[model samples]
Target: MTARWGNACDIVVFGGTGDLAMRKLLPALYYLHRDRHLHPQTRILALARARHEPEAYRRLVRRHVSQHVASADFSEDSWGSFSARLDYMPLDISQRLEFARLARHLGDSPGRVRVFYLATLPDLFAPTALHLHGAGLVDDQARIVLEKPLGESLATARRVNDQIGSVFDESRVFRIDHFLGKEAVQNLLALRFGNALFEPLWRNGHIDHVQISVLETVGVENRGAYYDQAGAMRDMVQNHLLQLLCLVAMEAPVHFEPEAVRNEKLKILEALRPITGMDVQDQTVRGQYSRGRRAGETLPAYYFEKSVDHDSNTETYVALRAEIDNWRWAGVPFYLRTGKSLAQRKSEIVIQFKSVPHRLFPGTTPEGNRLVIRLQPDESISLSLMAKSPGRGMALQEVELDLHFDEAFKRRRWDAYERLLLDVIEGDATLFMRRDEIEAAWRWVDPIIGGWQEVYRSPKRYAAGSWGPEAADSLLERAGHAWFDERGD
Candidate 1:
């Protein structure tokens, strides 16, 4: 069934009944509606092959939203209003007649903003866009949203971009990476540029090294099929971790607008010193998680995960030291590590400042003055500095000056999807990945992958409950550094 609001925008979700839709998108939309972020006239249309009436789909969404959303934020009145904006259509995207029917259902409104959010597989992105174009559904007011890990490799990514470009102009395309939407991630800009305290020391002269880690406590129990093929390199490193790196390393933009912000990010990506051949062996470490115990419970190894090959050589963990060729970060190593089934679930960036040239109180602080930006579990920014211990003669101890966003702001932090989805609807591409940005990231990543194929065939094995293989620690230890273990440290 199809319904329309008079001349308002139509936000169509391609994979309306999928996990992403139920868990992230619809719940986000509900919040936007509840908070009055969406326009009063806007209508949400969910497109999928799942056969269901409009009300049936809305009920299904209600159950999910209730489970995912916080009790304080959800209410019966808000849900009633939000559900009224939802409409569902059971149409197979591959069928031309289905698209034709969709066209008639949407009708032609030149002024209406039509957003086609493709939450399906990357292979379907181009075809769906072409289908929309062929059915006379695309216009100047139309925009398309594509999810991350655009393609498996550089070649496929370019091909997908080219195909989608043929239907929608670059300005009309939005490639989303939800990591960019995190509040703490965005606060990096304000911390670096908005304040004069840090920008001067943001370079190699004052900084020793940088660490970015996106660790998880869950294994690939259900996503084993996709995880086995892509591994940690393609799955996390290629997009999310890289995007975070760009933001942290990027030069201040002339303006905070879309193109200005993206242009600066692009420069950082291009300046990344490529890791290839022998450098891959020296700077990169890949590992597969082995079954182990954590917190008195046994965990399964990557090989035992559902849909994974017993002999799969895919890496469940990756740790690498990256450097930028540009002057600002020339000598500073940006260490990135990500893995599944780790001891903790947290995503963070640690900026280790250089120790005092002359320490008056020796052995007081071993970890040097540092700035830590926590992105998940809890979002906060903290700076660790040495303070004089009570009733002591210059006895120093490390104390953190912390700023928790929730406690400071006194409001609910919007979900990453909530901010990103609204950004798409309003045509603000500042937080999105551009076509060239995606390609540049792949170019830097491809050489490391190629080196793995040629020499490093099988990934080393580490206990599932541990950080990663011992080699990951060795990767940093050679440079007189170590992985920043939040819990241990």
Candidate 2:
């Protein structure tokens, strides 16, 4: 498939030498170039303090990008063209004097889209924007892309937003949550709003409950310090899981424009019933992983990870029941759980429908219809329905109607970063979060964090290879529903 190219733009990556840039950003750009999604004139400027000539930087990037990008996608011919668009500049983002060098490198190109991708820490976000604006780099056509863990808490998030908002318009700021860039996630929006088959039956009356889980097989690894500080709630739930929940529970936007979609999402975030104080104990579970074997390999516990505190109380896993108090989803509970070092690495959304009011077949048992959307490892959508057994009278069995992206489409699937990068260049914010949306999400998540700090001083311990704490299973069991992992996908 020929990938579509957006407007010619200069993509400036702040932390160009960082893990995210080398592993995701550069590789995504390479695919965009290979697939013809990037204009020939588009430039990718690496802005970091690491001093390197253009040739040396390209060589470094080539090694990392080659290692990370799929073997089939990496080609000498494509690399030649992609490498030509690469440039580098060494500077301290904190130093206002370094801004002039960046501006000079960008040149005085008119009407070209400029995307400042802040892949650096949250602290640098505002300063970078300020520096850009001070150096006359900010323009109407300029857009900024921010990464996750926007802030440590609600107050800090607000401050960050205020600082960034001062320099760039909200429309031009793309607060990216890569989960929204996943193929299954986009397909989910299409499944809910594009199709008439599920829309009417998507509410409380027909759907029993919703489960959104993002489980990781790997522990903190190199992110021990950051993970300890942020934990699962701030790192995963505040952005990824909550964004998925909003997409699942939100009302159909009048149109699929950026604001049209975000407006409805904002409504869902606002409608989220607060899980605070006593509610936190009853509705939420936080777990820290202990030493255990995964896939025949023994792994250290969260506390023992490099740079992590020996007695860290930080949660490696979190499970919470979120309710949206709105007409579309009044009684329905949205079960959200995300963790590291789990049974497997998978992200999926399960919509289990309510069972039939009365079973007509006496000799057979009917299972409720379920729509399972898997987001990682393998991207596919499967709907489980009860059907009559092939050769038996009155016998029913569950059958799945599945759509696997790789098998169904016979083309290379675009990574989340590739799609998001293209969207930023195209000036599309539909897949990105707005400032109000961020504030609202923090508003909903703040109290939960506070509740954990005040009441639950330490997280429950679970084995590294396990699903999560037993409390998480009991969380679902109390309501007569088990996690999809526990129930068998």
What's the true lDDT of residue 250 in model 2?
85
Flag clash pairs in model 2.
none
lDDT for each of the candidates? 0.91, 0.92
Candidate 1, after superposition: displacement of residue 212 in Å? Answer: 0.5
Q: How many residue pairs of model 2 clash at the backbone? A: 0
With candidate 1 superimposed using the best TM-score fit, by how many Å does residue 268's alpha carbon deviate from the native?
A: 0.6
Best by TM-score: 2
Estimate TM-scores for all models.
0.96, 0.97
After the best TM-score superposition of candidate 1, give how far the Cα of residue 9 lies from its true spot, in angstroms: 0.9
Provide the clashing-pair count of each candidate structure: 0, 0
For model 1, residues 1-489, the per-residue Cα lDDT tens digits are 133213358899999998899999999999888877887889899999999998999999999999999988899999999888899999898887789999888887777899999988777898999999999988888999998779888999999999999999999999999999999999998999999999999999999999999999899878898889899999999999999999999999999999999999999999999999999999999999999979999999899999999999999999999999999999999999999998899999999999887756755545579899999989999999988779948778889999999999987899999999888887899999999999999999999999999889899999998888999999999999987785563
